[model samples]
Target chain A: MSAPSQDLLARMALTFEAQQFLYAEARLLDTQNYKAWLELVTDDIHYWAPVVESRERRHRAGHYVAAADESAYFDDTRATLGMRVARLGFPGAWAEVPPSRMTRLISNVEVGEQGAEDIPVRSCFYLFRSRLETEEDSYHGVREDVLRRVDGELRLARRKIIFAQSVLTARSITTFL
Target chain B: MTFDVSRLVDLENGLIDRRIFSDAEIYDAEMDRIFRRTWLALGHESEIAETNDFFTTWMGADPVIVSRTAQGIKVMLNMCRHRGGTVCRVDRGNAKLFLCPYHGWSYNPDGTLKVVPGLEADYRHGIDPTQWGLLEAPRVATYKGLIFASWNPEVEPLEEFLGDARFYLDCLLDRVEGGTELVGGMRRWIIPTNWKHAAENFVGDSYHAAATHASIMRVPGLEGAGGRVKDVVGYQAALDNGHGVGMWMASEDNARGGYGHLAGIDDYLKSIQDQLVAKLGELRATRLTPVHATIFPNFSIEFPFASLHIWHPRGPLKTEVRDLTIVDKAMPAEMKDMLRRHCMLRQGPAGTWEQDDMDNWSQTTYSSLSPTARGLMANYQMGMGHEHTRDDIPGRIDNKSSDINQRNMYARWAELMAMDPPPPQVPAACRSHSGEISR
Candidate 1:
């Protein structure tokens, strides 16, 4: 076997860090520790999940994927995200009154576009949620995120989710992906 | 097929049978009696503006393709005539021909059978192409840019069916001179609730907001924002043909809060105030703004966010809520963006207010499944005799919190379910261009 190169070792180290960060973040979400999870994102975080549609490959130019100004599932800023988290603590939040049991399985962590201050990361997630006895839902999607260094700590600057299903089978997307 | 609706719906005292939401027999009857006879909204005209542009959807459980041919908009069954395979599987596309991948059965945009593979060699041209085209709906119509279709050829005209509801629909569709268009593609999700639960909710169920959406009020931007304009009383209109609308009397108070609690929509409406008044008059444009309405059967409109809902019935216990956001074509890009964001914040599968609604509606449906629950009557007697006719308003006017609209809708459902279904029409392929079937 050939000697290991310095660049390959650096890429492997970055991948391990990204996987660890993602696993910790998923644990926070699973534990319903939204306040702690919020700390992992930058103040100017752009969290969005565009509507995925089924269209022919020939008409894939602008129709297959949702446009910037088109319909989206979660188009949130930090403040808006905070409002959602705040609602979880309210008494009348019936959707989460009983609280959904959720487990997020994150895998396929790959690094892309490594920059000095920001790095783009891609991963696949399988979110399983069970609520109120027999109601169960599984959400399979891929998340594209931009991780930036804020005060020497890794923080999520942007996240865009692309779901695999054209029609959302889950009743509500209460948990973060 | 006739249903004994007498025991199920008792409109005299505003009592509805709980079985209507959980019964398989009633659900099957709805497909024949209601969905077949009534006009079902498919999509907006702008969705398939160009020739040959197409969008696929469902009419009841049946898959359909709504396409625009050079002649006009054509809606046909998406199934191939040869086999039961879907011809056009995608959601939206621009295709002049829909070729079935099963055995290469191709169809024109107008649903006429175009070509069949191995026609000369395999079948020796024995099959007639005209008599084997895709099955098309009997009646298709459009009111304002919304396209609707019905399977009954003897169904009433769309305008007559819409009746006085047009006045309210125009408030949302024709507010500006340029008219409205759907901003982008639709957002859809499945809810484990009866379709009527969703339909009746939009049919002036203003009472559900306080309890069902209590958490939404705590949100900063959505605080105290909904169909009702702040400080202004709203009225629920139970129109003819089961259509219902809940609207607030347009007032100066609208300038402060009503536009779904968004910050800039009030100022944007002010900018186009004159244009709106000129187009819709003072009554529609200024004095009356319908917030949410259901046009019978399953189509619904929410004006605050300029979104439309099609509660496509999946079964007795499931509903596929398909939503499309609309905006005036004359509005600037910024206003459109604001409305789009507002819709996302409040109404899709992940909507803040809508999330709670799903929980309530699903639980409501789940409880109704018990035999004891189904035997009990679901009370709808909030404001029974209090419903009075209004000279200014065009329908039976009731208080915003009343169940008058729900009673009216059930009355209409019973009337439809009691009637004998129309005779089945000849197949589209076997019919002539003038719609006369020839042997």
Candidate 2:
């Protein structure tokens, strides 16, 4: 591939903007402003995090396999996620009663254009959570997303989350990653 | 105060001696008495479709290997016979040999001794590899598609043990033609809570759903559409041999209608209703919707959604849970996929409904650890002694909200614990009130 010209360099500048946007999204989660966080997603957003099998090395085929059709931790459309957020607001959503103290570190942004307005971006994340009287629960994963630039704002259209731990030690993912 | 098995539970009253939730001695006794003798669920047969395929899990605290060999399916202790190390560390896979990472001891898929590092040079008199095969469970049986094993060779037949619970179990497992296939990987996690808490809840705690899972029923815009939520209209059965099944439905078609949350259960079951009717008759086909049954100690299956989990007792105050989404083999892969997604969101390890449950269970377990709280007894007085049997459902059934299911489970638990005889003696100082320790 030829080196990027000045125009390509300018387009790549969007990478910095994308990183800033993710940081802001993380801040929303950390501050427990999940209601507002919904604004960052498109109306038709599809978020999924498939369950990972703990297979033997020989059976793994030398790579990690996460099937989209299989059971998952989170597979929410815009409506489902909205309900989920609304549920979190309910006093009966006891899992978030003493809402989990969360810190999401997003890094390693790799971005490319999907269409004129949609950008497919991939990044790694380390999510740390602390619940009532518990030390901490750490969850790390890779998130693949398609972000659409709607009216100069990047809105998540789709997300495919893959976690590092096939056998999760956390009691629950009380907070969004 | 230490464990006093005799007072661990009050046999006469319906009070569960809270110490049983955190006692080391009672936990130890249970490992030998109840867990060893009872039929515990391991995995579905469909999980290991091909020969050499295996699914690893726990039967209580002991790690067990369920593998399919050329001969047949084998359920054996995952511990190495040579040095007691884990023979197979992986969860599920196709493997030719069970190799122990510690001492390089390998066994065939059937757990027969294959190669032991340097067998030829190590001993002058050759050791008998024949006597060194993996310790297999004495009794292993399957009904519908769910496989269960018992450590006691003399235990009752799995069918006989399951008894009336079979009728309801068939509603889920036997619904599919070629039986059920375990879709999706097992979701395994740990919780600091007694296994009994989870087991007893599934045993029959239907009342908790209304207040505990209100959010699930009243999803955002669809608040009063109510999904599958209904008034207390179903029954709970304390089946033969300690097993219990709690069932609730809104008529026939609307029974499991709220399972997937996407396609609604009526639409999903409509295609399979004929098959279910042919297999289970009209009443069972439509009536048995949302079923949650626990096979005694820790095996639980949630129906329509088709999620099965085992609460493997880690200690008196800790548990390791492993779950999987199962679907009928004859169903289209897409529908199975949908059920898989539904089960995940509804009750997977980090599920919306499940997360709420973890909060209560974990907190209760933590509170019970305090010395001041260990002696208190939990009540099981919902519908004891006064529950009536239903005409359609088999076994002694009660209203969905009644605590009879929980009471009957403790009755069975008391029976099983009595079988082991109060551990010979309890420390004199640990004794408290009559049949209970009041710290």
Candidate 3:
């Protein structure tokens, strides 16, 4: 009926479409189809998980791992991610050989601001991941994503995860969360 | 029955009887002796450097709140005296006072009871606030920003507790001007193994590095760096107080030379070398390169990598491990970021190295629970007769990578377990409005 209403409906449709793309990406991870999952990311994508501490600006006050000083977990280019994937596929990636079955439950989808190129985009995710080997194995965190539309196909330009639990229960994080 | 302590003395020769790991009675004795008496590492001083800052953790099975007060740092029992309710809930934060959720009782960060809800009108004279503050741990002390507390008052002083291990620690901690700081947030995970397994792994288990992390070494560009998956050249320093450090020497064939073989270790280590040579002479500086050690029961610091401190809280059949990693305050931002990534990738709940270790640890616990596996013992016979007293070094330095550190740990465990129960301290005299109660 009205031009403004029509524009609002069209925008909503694009947002929903972007949300569906994220859900599909999560499904690929849950199924351990990392090859298909890699196809969803841009070539120069940054996957970072910054360690959040109790105190502000005090670098060493809260970290609990040897490598906490310098890098984010999974800080890598496409090349590094490929190397990790290759290691997983290797016959002796002992950590993942008898791969722990996982389920990545992503929810609370909401579309956010569009990027510079007017790439139809959104950001919203809560990933609750669990490995089937043990009762105490689980990880749940929120992800802030930047999606870019290339040739009418949505792809992840960047993803930053912030974990809710200060103390993790999983024995080892062999799979992506 | 012929009496012989030799069977129990396998620990002296760096040979641990596997029974100590799976025995219910030994674990129970350890709770009474080791956990109850020793000055357990609670948290770092930096965790609560400012007043009102607090961190909640467990000392053995007893929940504890380590807080910074106007007076100083205070480690108190987390349980409220009134109704056993936890005074602080969140993992950590800055709070002036802690108010119990079950009841409205409140306590200052110093652990003094400050308020009781709705009490003035009803039996005001009977309720004395002074007697109801959170219970203070018997002893609290710090060594180079590392905080430790003891439940038993009769336990030895902190310096004496550290004993010979202090000499080795000075090589790492004292080398830096302000000492090292913990970076980012702690990467904690629950490994299904007993605490001893994790402690021994870090203490003197360079022997397993090559095999456990073979894939990490296989990474192409990383092969040149001496940080690869090989045990290489290393020496184990076993101290008098059951503490020990393993120093891995750089391979002689490496073109770069010395500790330089490690990845991203150039600047900070060079500074450490300069400081160590200034303080402890060239020989000690060279010998102390690549030092990683466990402080008694569970606290371990790996110079150049990160500090690891584990708290072992045991149930009848399970052990909960709380581990923290420490990085240097002076480290470059990029290095700190790389170290954190490396930590998560290798040791966190989802690290490559941790995966193999956890599987073994869990299986060990599971198999130990089986009926048929009840009396069987895990072997620790490596380097049994091969170890000898070295005149040049201070502590017992084992020539090869061996299970001597684990044996030393169990020996200390047995010593603590066999010690006489410490005498209880006199309770503070209770004061009532009517009069003071002597009881």
lDDT of each: 0.86, 0.77, 0.65
Model 1 agreement with the true structure over A76-115: per-residue lDDT tens digits: 9998889888887788989887999999999999999699
Tens-digit lDDT track of model 3 for B1-439 = 1212246446544444455555566666566667777888877887787888888887776788999998888998887878779887666778888889897889999999988886787657677778778888878999887889988887899999998787767765666566766654565656666667767777777787666666666664322232322335667877776787877544434422344444566655565667667776655555435456788776776655564656465553455555455666666777666565545455555555566667666666666667666555567767666666666456777854777766777677667766754543324543344342111
Can you give the TM-score per candidate against the true fold? 0.95, 0.89, 0.85
The residue pairs found clashing in candidate 2 are B257-B265
> How do the residues A70-99 of candidate 2 rate in per-residue lDDT, one tens digit apiece?
667888888878877878887888888777
Please give, for residues B27-135, the per-residue lDDT of candidate 2 as tens digits: 8778777887789888888888899999888877778899888878889888887768998877787888988999898999998899887888886437777777787
The most accurate candidate by DockQ is 1
Better of 1 and 3 by DockQ: 1
lDDT score for residue B310 of model 3: 68
Chain B alone vs. reference chain B, TM-score for every model:
0.94, 0.88, 0.86
Residues forming the 10-long window of minimal summed lDDT in candidate 2 chain B:
B421-430
Over 4 Å off, model 1: A1-3, A61-63, B1-3, B224-230, B250-260, B428-439
Candidate 1 structure lDDT: 0.86
Per-residue lDDT tens digits for candidate 1, residues B121-155, read 99998888888888889899998899999888999
The model with the greatest TM-score is 1
User: Residues A113-136, candidate 3, lDDT per residue (tens digit)?
Assistant: 565643433343444443435543
